[model samples]
Each structure stands twice: as structure tokens, then as C-alpha cells.
Target: MLPFFTNPYPDELLYSAIARYHFYSGNLDCKDTLEELFGSRSVIPSVEIGSNFTILAEKLGHQYSVESLLTNHTIYPYYASFLSKQRQQEILENVKGDGQGLYTRLGIVAGGICRKDGLYYCSTCAKADAECYGEPYIHREHQLQGIDYCSHHEIPLRKYPKTNDSRIEYIRFELKHMDLSPLYEIDSHKELAIHLAKQAYKLLNLPLHYLSREQINSKYRTLLREYNLITSSNRVRQQEMYQAIKSTLPNSFLQRYESAVNNNDEYNWLRILTRNLKRHVHPFRHLLFLYFLQYSVEKLVDIDEDDGAFGRGPFSCLNKAAAHYKKFIISNVIVTRDFKTKNLIGTFTCSCGFIYSRKHTTDMFEIGRIKAFGDVWLEKLHDLQQQNLSIRAIARELGVDFKTVKRYLIGNVEIKQVKSHRDNDDILGIYKQDLLKEIKKHPNLSRTALRNKYKKQYMYLYRYDKVWLDEALPERRYGQNTIKKVNWAKRDQQYVQEINRLHQKLLQSEKPIRITISKIGKSLGTLANLEQHLNKLPKTNKLLNDIVESVKDFQLRRCYKIIDDLLENDQEIFLWQIQRKAAIKSHHFHAIQPMLESYIEMKQEVTNNERTTS
Candidate 1:
């Protein structure tokens, strides 16, 4: 009296003593038994099978028609993968029952099994062989553990997988988050963008083989996860960069370009950035690689080309990558002395295919002014070379992602280290054989006792001599010292040698100027003549002859103003008779202000004086 559905196979099931094959192992009227069993027993099916025999043929993996074979196995008109015309002819000859089966072949997407309604299910979707979960007996209970389920399909969906390939792909799919209005991250180059969209259509929209459904589902699941992470993170960073750059653009971001001021467009800066991206080597080098990846890709079943082998030599992946990023060399960039003069302008093409020019000039004398795109990339590549810093330290110092730093460092440096595994350390051989002899002699010696015995007595023997131990052990010669006395003595000698080096350096240096307390007064008196007119003073102009050649003579004359201002600061300094009137003066000040009480009196007196003088 066991239950009818006792031990169901993971994929296939026949109800025996308890919903298994032994009960109906004889293939006893599949149609009639199902009908009788449904009517008699209240047993529920975990999976539902379809009614049509043609569907049964497909679920069980037998070809029924040409269309079914082509779509199901990825077989095609001429350039097909799975089945040839001869195979199709054989399938038609062997598996097809009648014209009725061939008529139903048009339905399968990537395969001939449909589980649209809640009754019929594919065993791949369910845990049963060729049973439809979405149709009549769709069981949500059969969904995979730890995942949300389609009530229709009754299978667990893949959420995450433990692999790098899946992780990167999952980030790529989170791109739906990038749907900020109508803007799109067209790949670094528009051509790559166009090609990628096509690949996206093929990969995302098309279905995989029914036989490979497990593989396909796994791949897509991983892709979705990676896509989510990549798009979300990059979109956030891009938003921040856009906001930052927006503020620094011209005219409160209303005008970003020289032309924007003329045209008064709000998005002129964005337009300019887009135009510059098309022409710039910075984006284009990355662009070409993406473009090649897209264009060179074929279906997974396509033959691997000999010419496309990666990491070979000469015309290998390295060479092709180098050639791919080679720049269009433009020469003889002109420079002008004045910025406002006619100069070479950086040219750019816009997204709408119009050229924009900006006022920029390349220095004719500067060496790296006219480098190719490949040259600039090579310079960036050189930065990853191992010079002084460790990889982690370099990444932290440069403020770049660890992965980005690791990519370059691994490519340029790590590979070299791995190839040259040359370790030249001394081998102080640890012979465990010596310990076995002591263990045999003293069977129960405690670890401390063993150590004391080995050191005190064994060391007194020839191999580990006590005479040598007395000389080696610090307690015998220099007691109560933390560091070994010999090591301390050596360090002390090094310290003395360093002191001698510093003394020699001090002797080599010239003696500094000695300042006497009396020299301060004499220096101030002589420094006053420096305040006189340049032509009146002896060699005042010659003293600044070199300085005046680079800067104007007016600037040289201003140097004397330093002395004039300093002299004015001293109240004890003598003043000369002035030809000007009202010459009563304050020290260090250009002029004295009249008091508030004397203001009106001064105005009246000054007016009277002017009138009297006239």
C-alpha cells in the first residue's frame, strides 16, 4: 500500500506501484490509461503532456517535417548547421507519419515544442520528459528552488552563476537602466554601435536549440546579471561627469563653443563634444577594436578562420591590434607668436556628419605635437612597465580601477615575470633526519626539555659544538642584550660611517655669508642710493642690464620703488626741502588725511589760497 507516485525519474516517469513505470510498465494504452486514470483516481500530474502525436514525436526527439527540422536543429536552406538535405530526406522517409504531421511544423520557435497554454510542457522546462507545464496542468510548485517562476512555465529561472563569463555578460544586460529618455551609449564609435545593435538583435531575439536549452538559459541568465551591474554603475558615473563638465562649459552651459556664442544654442557644448569624439584618436582606437570584433564575428557554429588566430606572431593578434589603431598622420602643424593670429584649428565631425572647427594651435617646436594615434597608445602602454612601484600601490596612486591597472600591468609586466622564473636564494637545507635520532633516544622528553637537552648537550658535541655555541650564544659574551652584540656592533660601524659621510659633505659646502650687527646700519645707508633715478645713480641701469633685457625697463625701475617705500617707513629719516606747498608729511604714507573737524576749514583755506595764487 505505497502511494502511486513513489519514485519519479528526474526526466521521465511512469506510474508504477506509486506513480512509476512498474504500474503501467507494459505501455498499456497511453491514451486510454490516461483517460481512465483521470476519471478513476484524483492523482495530480507534476507535468502535463500534449495531446497531438506529432507533438509527441518532437518531445521525444524524432524529426516530423522539413520546417521542424530546420528551425529545431538550426538547420537552414543552404548554409545550415545540423541537418543536410540528405538527412532531411532520410527523416521524412523514416519518422514522418503522414501529411498531417508536416502541416503542424510551422509553430516551434527555434524548435517545434510549444508550451503556450497551461497543459502541455517540455520535459526540459519541467522535470518530466516532454510534459507541458504551462498548459492544463501547469504546476508552479515544480519551479526551480530559490528563483522566481513563470506560473505558465513552472521552471526556476537562472538568477546568478559562479563564473566570470556569466558575470561580465550579466552586467551588459542591465542596459535597460540606460534608457534615460532617448539617449543611448552608442559604442565608443558609431560604426561599432551599429554593428553591436545587429548582434544584439541576433543574440537576444533569436532562440537557441531545444537540445541546448540548458546551455542557452544559463548563458542568458549570466549575461543579465553582468549587464545590470555594468550599465547601472557606468550610467551613474556618466551622469556625474556630465553634470561636472556642464558647469565648466561656456556661458552657464548655454553656450559651450565659440560658435555657440554666435548661434545662442543651449546644447552647443554637447554638440561640440559629440563632434570631437568622432575625430579624436582617444575614442577611435577603442572604436576600431570594437568594430573588428563585431564585423569579424560569425555564428558559433561557423568555422574558425586560420587568419584570425589570436596571440600568434608577426601578423598575429598583436600586430593586427597595432595596425588597427594606427592613426592618420597629419604633419606640419603651424604655430603663431600671438594667440589671436591665424592658427591651426582642431577639426571634428559631428554625429549629423557636419564638420566643426575650434581655435587651437600645435607648437611647431614641441616634439610630441604631431604623434600618431598608435604612438599615443604606445606611450600609455609604456606607463604600465615595472619601474619602482608594486601593482597595488600603482593602482592606488593613479586613482584608477584595480582591474584597469591590473590589465596593463599583467599584459606588460606580469607576463614577463612569469616567463622568467629565476629564483636565486640560498638553500639552508632543513634536514628533519637529525630530529628522528633525538626522538628515538628520548622517547618522552617534553618539547622544552628536548630543546634544552639538544642545545646544552648536543651543541657541546662536534656537529653542533658547545665551543661554537658559547661563541654564538649572546649570553656567553654580551649578556642582557636584545639584539645580537655582533649585529649591534656592525650597525654601529655603519652609523659611524654615515656620520663621516655627513661631516665630509659639510666640509665640502662653501661657508655661508656671516652677518654682523654693524653691517645692518651700513647696508641700509648704501641701499638708499638704489632709490635714486636710474640715470642719476652710478650703474643703476647696468646693475639691472640682464633683467631689463627680458622684462621692460619700467619693471626694472619698479625695483627701486622697494627702497623708496622702505625709506618712507622710517620716521627718523631726514626729508629734503620741497618746492610743492603743504609738504608736512607722515612716515611710510603717500599723503596725510585732514581730520573731520578740519575738513570744512581746509576746503575754505585751500579755495582761498588758490584764489590768492591766481
Candidate 2:
């Protein structure tokens, strides 16, 4: 091996260390340093991720390896963490050799988000480096695409002027060329910029293949569901989600990175990021989206093993007739969709063979419909029937309807008839003839009216010759003339109780669903009635007026939910974070701005008081 090379500094780019070698080795050209380090003068230097590390490792002796250089000295880990295992291996191999197609494979060449045109450095970091090590080196974190601020300093980074020969030359940081002045004044966007920087830095330091593409996708889908960006039908609410992300970051900040969302463009970077996990997205876009989701690198990688619409199984059986009722013995769940509602429906099958289905939600336990009662239930029904129990009593015992009991036990039951002279053929024929004559006389009247007009003849034929009576009567016409009066007071009382129960349920739900009159009415299957006859149901009307939420009210509830989430995690409360999580538009947040601030202040006081007392 040649004379000792310049050692890499903490988080220094491999390129930066090599450029320092060129300066220290008295090399007149970068190619000379390349030849000495890589044993090949034609190996091109990449700013972010350098190539041909295998040769450089050999020239540098046993002190370094290709894998070590790639993982430690270069920015490969940040991008590799989001790639598949096979792709990570492919990129590692490429970095070890000539690195042909490396940028293409990493999706950087055409990654939409533009990389910095020249080397970037933080003034504070550079000054500190100069004092500590007698020189400053290019930091890998500073050179990342879409990272505008220094993660450590939380200040805007300055860019070094590029030379005309940048394509062939490796630029080293020089104290003389450093512009230590601030690049831009701190504004409202600075906080967001710093967030991106910090998250990007964390990703840069992550271990290779820390997360796979599938894991990231799963994590995203789960979070999307939590944020209400995905429907119960497993469909991504793309437009609403897009607007939420768009509002999270300032337009100028996104524009600077060439990552601005185009509303009309169907194939924008954000859409592509969520749509296709196999297609590589630049780490910049990935980090940006993670910010929109209120996630850090650690949180995004902490994926749930089962993040399906219906979460992990060993689901509970809802069969009331079985021995394992409400027990978590079911390991099988067949997920399908409701053809009419397009909502996800999960069918649970137990070992006892009882089957049932319901609409899928995180905490839903009620069965929508039963597909089969299985053999155990049928045997139970037979045993119950052996006691000569009435159909209603059997239904109550077996957890079914009286009609269901009758349908199942009809063939086994014996019907007894009393002997009567009305059953005679001549008498039945006379009753049928009289019913047919009455029906012909009242052709315009309904069957009920005809029956009322000829009550004696109808009753005689109804008991003795019901089938003949039905055939002789005309088809009943259901018109306004046949309408009956309804008891409005009874209907009102029934609806009020149902609405009250639903209101209580909404209050206990973990996720906030906006309460409106329409939502409450539709959920209780009384929308049409509530819409037209709400005034008639005075109690329901009053309860609705008191519970239905306005736009601002719903937004405030969301803010409170977000606050509770932060407190549960022991995270500090921040207005920007609350706003982002709540997904409230800026103008709308203004409406509840004072209340949010007051609530936060109150919570802080309580927390502080508790700490003081302890």
C-alpha cells in the first residue's frame, strides 16, 4: 500500500475524503489521486455515492472494506433503507466495482427532485471543523437532495461555487471560498426546513436494509388509515390526501426542491411514491412524505406485522349458539367487499363451523349477517325441540328468529284440523261463489275493502276455503285511499332512543368522526324520515341540534385528539405539529386558534403541576 491516506471524518462523504487526499498527496490532478487510490484513473467520482470502492479498499489495505466504505462513508444507507433487499445487494455490488448504472438503479438520475448543483456546507459546521481539525470537509448530510438546512445547526446551508470542470474534478471545501453569511432569513418555513433536514440526517445514518420496500409500504398504509386518508374499502383518498400534504409544506419550499405537487398531473412524485413501492423513489421524496405523515425515520420503519384492512387474526367468533361464542379461537378470516357499499367485509369461520360476516373496522365486533349455523346449532335446535317447546321459545334459546325456527322445524311438526260442516265440498263451493261475486262487484276496491264489505261471506270462506278465497279476490292496489294513520308520538319516542344510543357510541369512539345531522340520521337508517319528518320527532330534533358538529367544532375535536396522541407519546406540544396532524386548513385553524392555545396552556399547567407535586 502507498503512504497513509487522509482518514475520513465523522459523517464525511467518501468523495470529500478522497478530494482531501488529492490536496494532501501533492497530486496535480484529481485523476492522479484516483489512480493512487483506486489504481484506475478513469474511475469517475460521484458526489453523494462514490464508485469502485473494491479497488480503493485494496489500495488502502485491510483498514477498509468495500462494504464499510459504502455504509459508513457514502450516502447509500439513506436510499438503501427504503429499497428491497435484492436491490440493496445490487447497489452494494455496483458500488464495490465500477458503479455503472448505480445512479439509475438508485433512481437519482431521473428522481424528479433535483440535487444541489454544487457542494453545500454549513457555516457553523465548517467553522467548528476548522478549529477542531485544522480543516473542514464536506458532510454527506449537507449534500443530500431536498435538505436545505443544517440538521445540527438548524440553519440554512451555503453552497460552494462550482468549477467548469466539475464533471471530471473533485471539489474540496476550502476556508477561503466559504461564504459564512446566512443564505436566507429565518421565516415561517424554517421550522419545516429544519424538520426535513433532521429527518434526512437520521435516514442518512440508518443501517443498510433497515427497512424493506414492503415494510415502508405497510407502514404508510397503516398510517394513512389512521389519518383517514384511506377508506374502509381499502381505497386511498388520493385527492384529499394530496391536498393535505400540499398544505403541510410551503409552496416555495417544495418548488425549490422541484418536488411541488401538481394537482392536474396524475403521475406526480407523491402519487408515484405511494402507488408503486417497487419503483424506487429518491430518498428526498421519501423523507418529505414521512414528514407529511408526521413520522420520523424510526417511526416509519416500525411497521406492524399485520396492517391489513382487518388487522391480524385469531379474530373473535360472533356465534351466540356455539360454545366458543365471542372467543378469539378463529384463525381464519376471509376478507371480501360489500357489492353495494364497496366497504370491506370480513367473513370469520370458526373451528365449530359457524360462519358470520361484518363490515371491517378497527374495533367492530357486531355481526352483520350469518352465513351458516353449522351442525352444532342444528343439533341444539333439535334437542330444544324435543321438549316440545314453542317456536318462539326455541328461537329465544337458540339465538334465532321465531320465523327461522318455524322454517327449519316445519317439516317435522304435525298440524291437526278440527272437523266442521264448513269443510264440506258443497258448503266451500257456495262460499267461493259468494266471494267471487263480491270481488267482481268491487273490482276497483282493494282486497281489504272487499273483505270489509262482505265480512260474513269473507270470514266463512277465509276459515274454510282460504286458497279459493284468495284466488277469487282481485290483486290489492296500494294507493293513497288504502293509507292508514300512523302514531307520530310513538314513532318519535322510538327514534329518540335510537339516536341517543348512537350519540353515546360516537362519544366513545377512539377516532373522531365528524358528527352531523345527516351522519347521525343515515347511520341509524332514518335519514329519509329525519330529513322530511324531523320536526314531528321533537326529541330527536332537539338532540340532533345539540350534538351535530359544525366545521369549526369538528376541527377543534381533531385538535384535541391530536393533543391527546402527543401527550400519550410524551412528545412536546407544538402548534405546527398539531396543525399538521389535525389536517385542518390554515384559514380554518385560525377560527379555533385561540381555543387551541388556551387548551394547550391548560394542559401544560396541569402537567407542570403534577411534576412539581411529585
Instruction: Pick the lDDT winner.
Output: 2
Worst 10 residues of 2 by lDDT: 411-420
Candidate 2 lDDT over residue span 19-133, tens digit each: 8888889888877887898888788778888888888888888988888888788878778777877888898898888889898788776563666788889999999999999
TM-scores of all candidate predictions against the true structure: 0.15, 0.59
Query: Model 1: per-residue lDDT, tens digit, 386-505?
Result: 466666665565434467567765566322111112321111112223444666676665554545755534333334333543332323222367454244344334433543444345
lDDT of 1: 0.29
Identify the candidate with maximal TM-score.
2
Q: How does model 2 score by TM-score?
A: 0.59
